[model samples]
Target: MNRRDTILVADDVEINRAVLRSIFEEDYNVLEAENGEQALFLMRQYRDSIAIVLLDLIMPVRDGYEVMEEWQADPSLRGLPVAVITADDSVESEIRVFDLGASDIIGKPFEPHLVRRRIQNIVSLSQRHLDQDDCIREQARKLRESNAAVIDALSSIIEYRSAETGQHIKRIQLFTRVLLEDVAANCPDLGLDESHIAMIVSASSLHDIGKIAIPDAILNKPGRLIAEEFEVMKTHAVKGCEILSRLDRMGDRDYLK
Candidate 1:
């Protein structure tokens, strides 16, 4: 019921742990562990408060895979969403983690904003699971409401960072909703539904969210950017994609869908 949720960050490296801690500490209550054993112990001690776990694959005593297996074996902890935050990028490792009951995996050397979005999505999902009933309709309704709130909040943050008016987000949401509806009506085979439309509308507001990372001179320039400035502008799309990609792993495929 708390506005801000709690997150557990488990990593062997002090620098990695500090980096993750710094990302979420301001917005969420963060619990840290140096390795898998400490992570498991903390989970057991504060199981109720912990909403999600950001786990590292390599550790001294009991690795992330081992911790995941242990959690899956325990009835009480089986439902907890474990997101692997590892440097491993191999296809086999990804498959293995999913097979081991990990809910998501994030590759390391990550962007701070991307990490924040991912943690927020997983925390939101975990909270929804706890608060909503088992019925699909109820779950869907709760998800829609939660997603709306999240997208709105994120858009507001983006707007705050830009010189553009807040109406930009509002207009984008309306336009995107209409455009998606038209698409769904014309292409039924695309599997676009109310859920998909809502996601599109919500996510469209973020299409230009990465512009916030751009320098004000380029972002707010009245004229076209030069070759170098245009290249910098292009990074906004990549940044936006990265931010949404991390959230995609948290089970909200709507953004990237």
Candidate 2:
């Protein structure tokens, strides 16, 4: 498998295109475009294959600014690296290109070796950023799984003590998720996204966590309790709050706080 990255050289001037093509041809596959329209066409067709773009600011059809604008409008094209090849070295031109998402700008009469190094550096940096993002996402996934396991274990201890079926916990989670989904869909003002809904559903499993503080006699009693016993049972909510507060302080857990 050929692992070489493809570089698109978009310039109206044939000599300029030839120079860049000759420079990078050994290390990369070169695609030439005489105008921005052709450049955009080739970009869309070989979007995954193209690694970076070398675009001329002044072109016959669309020009570099228009090309960058169109690229920015399309979400998928936004991440593709582009470097503007421009004769104008003014501060305004530099700012405009940067705002339009050009990774780098090569001034007119740029050294061949320097251009090669700059393009390579941008590609390397972009790859590093992408790798870091993947690492962060994987870490988040593992953290979520670990949190879920701890919650299930803690909830199960309370269930076992109270002689309640595991289905009781599952049902509460299910109901909470359903209601949250409904609210999210019908009430956009609530600002409940998928993450928020998932969090609330997971938290619903801990509603009976307070039962862990209640005496087994009161917790597992089949008959109605006397007023004094009932009042003691009512304290379970406050007890759960106290227990959670203590755990938060001890562990310094951000979510608990």
lDDT for model 2, please.
Answer: 0.83
User: Cα RMSDs of all predictions?
Assistant: 20.0, 7.1
Best by TM-score: 2
Q: Runs in model 2 with CA error above 4 Å? A: 1-4, 147-257
- Residue pairs clashing in model 1 are none
* Model 2 agreement with the true structure over 103-149: per-residue lDDT tens digits: 99998776999999999998888767666766765665566676777
Q: Compared to the true structure, candidate 1 yields what TM-score? A: 0.51
Per-residue accuracy of model 1 over 1-257 as CA lDDT, tens digit each: 33336789999898998998899888778899998999999888877778789999999899998999888876667657889998899999999999998878888897999888887788788777766534555665666676777677778878877646477878888988888899988875565778668767766787876776788888878897899999998999888777776666345444456
Using all chains and alpha carbons, the TM-scores for the candidates as numbered come to 0.51, 0.56
Candidate 2, number of clashes: 0
The lDDT for every candidate, in the order shown, is 0.80, 0.83
